[model samples]
Target: MAKDDSDIYAALLQAIERGEFQPGSRLIETELAERFKVSRTPVREVLNRMESQGIASRDGKGGLIVAELSQDQLGELYDIREVLEGFAARLAARHAAPAEIELLKEMIASGKLVEGEARELAIANKQFHQQLHNCTHNQYLQQMLSSVQRSLALLSGTTLAEPARVVVSEKEHRMLVEAIENRDEDKAEQVARNHVKNAYKTRLKIELGW
Candidate 1:
């Protein structure tokens, strides 16, 4: 099947996420046009969309580059998300129906049996999170959180990529699921908050060797 501009957009975002196009790596229009087998018009449109989301930036050298997030920028992004997503979890705990809570626990358990392409693993992680948002049952919160996370696309590695880190992440996910299932709103929020906070620190270590 012939692909379209949206496909190119997704391909570019995936490339950025995979570290295939690292922070500050130049995105040559001609190269992208050829790679996506599309005209430069669509490539430019995708680049503009990325820039609006802060995923790419004008390099001032007549080309665009994947946005380079400083340590401070990274901290800010995750900190905002931690607060926002933590509240979302708390709401989900209080308002989610019994079936929704059960489904969450099931997904948490699903993490136990995982092996695949790194991209597939990452995608599962994304689905797990999207499920959490659905549990929240707030359209606005879910929409905003989704937008914020899209900006996070420039990040290369998930904490899940660290050796044995998926084990720890899975454990934390279980805790959050239990907290939600039990309708312990505070505990759910705290656990969800801490989970994201720790992931941010792990990302720092991975990115900065700190």
Candidate 2:
């Protein structure tokens, strides 16, 4: 793909993630083109790419709308994520270098310092998880985790938005990183799974008012 096309695609994805377009909202090519200051051709190309990823789909009126996940679908997604992330943590424990472990610790420390800034903390949290995935040194696992991360963008708002949740999340990150640093694969895997489970619980509370 050309650079412009890639940029437009990334921009559209970010817009969706930020809830600017909203779930199930129609995405008109002309409107998107005007919003992004791009031409219709690039917008069309971006929309096609999004459709292939199941991020957007054709509505009853034959126009594309943001894809919304059902409750069952969201639960399934979290279940898969729990398994994959736990495996990644196990692999990372065995494979991560000393420097990688140190980096993960630093990321957690930085996140703690940004307690009041939900947006910044959310980005930090994402970077920390992505870093852990890379530490696993398995390209296929990394790709799968990346797809799961994209699906999470469909959910509005960040779990880190809650101050209490942020503190608990930071503690979970610390425990997972410590397990990886000690090369305790079992502990790392268990901590990682619990981390994701807690996140799913928080997501349910926020999205479903459960």
Candidate 3:
């Protein structure tokens, strides 16, 4: 990938992740090229790569659109997340450095300051999970978790959007950290799994407009 192409790719990915290019929204190469002030060739390449990564898909009309997950697909995605996150927490309990533990604690503390701010807390939540993935000390696990996180960006809105969910999620994060701090791998894994489960429930409710 040339520098320009890399830049274009990253920008497009960010746009998708930020929900600017919403799921099922068409990605017209010519329009994207004009929007990014680049040639259609690079836009086409970026779209191709995104399609291969499951970030974009064919619309059955010979055009590309942002990937959309059906309800069943969403449930399957969360199932994978539950297992991967639990394993990451278990590994963190076994392998996280003292500094990493302190960093997670600091992150949780900062998260408290954004209690009522759903968007901020949502971003913080992602960072916290990424830290946990880093603490796992397994590159393969981290890579898989990273891919899951990217796929999650296809879902619009955050579970933390509700103030009640935000409060509950904060407590869940604290519990996981405490379990890890105590070096209780089983407890950490269970807590992390529960957290993902709660998130899945909330997401399902949101999807159902409840």
Q: Which candidate gets the maximum TM-score versus the true structure?
A: 2
| CA-lDDT, candidates in order | 0.83, 0.88, 0.89
* RMSD each, Å: 2.1, 1.9, 2.1
> Which candidate, 1 or 3, has the higher lDDT?
3
Q: TM-scores of the models, in the given order?
A: 0.89, 0.95, 0.93
For residues 1-210, could you state the per-residue lDDT of candidate 2 as single tens digits?
A: 234888887877777778898889999989888887878998898889889988888888889999999899899999999999999999999999999999998877764425658767877788899999999999999999989988888888888887778878888888999999999999999999999999899999998875
Count: clashes, candidate 1: 0
Error of 1 at 96 (Å): 2.1
Write one digit per residue (lDDT tens) for candidate 3, span 1-210. Answer: 334778998888878877899999999988899888988998898989889989899998978999999999999999999999999999999999999999999998874525646667777888888898999999999999988987998988888887778878888889999999999999999999999999999999999999
TM-score for candidate 2: 0.95
Q: After superposition, how far is residue 74 of candidate 3 from its true place, in Å?
A: 0.4
For residue 61, model 3's alpha carbon misses the true position, in angstroms, by 1.0
Candidate 2 yields a Cα-based lDDT of: 0.88
Instruction: Write down the TM-score for model 3.
Output: 0.93
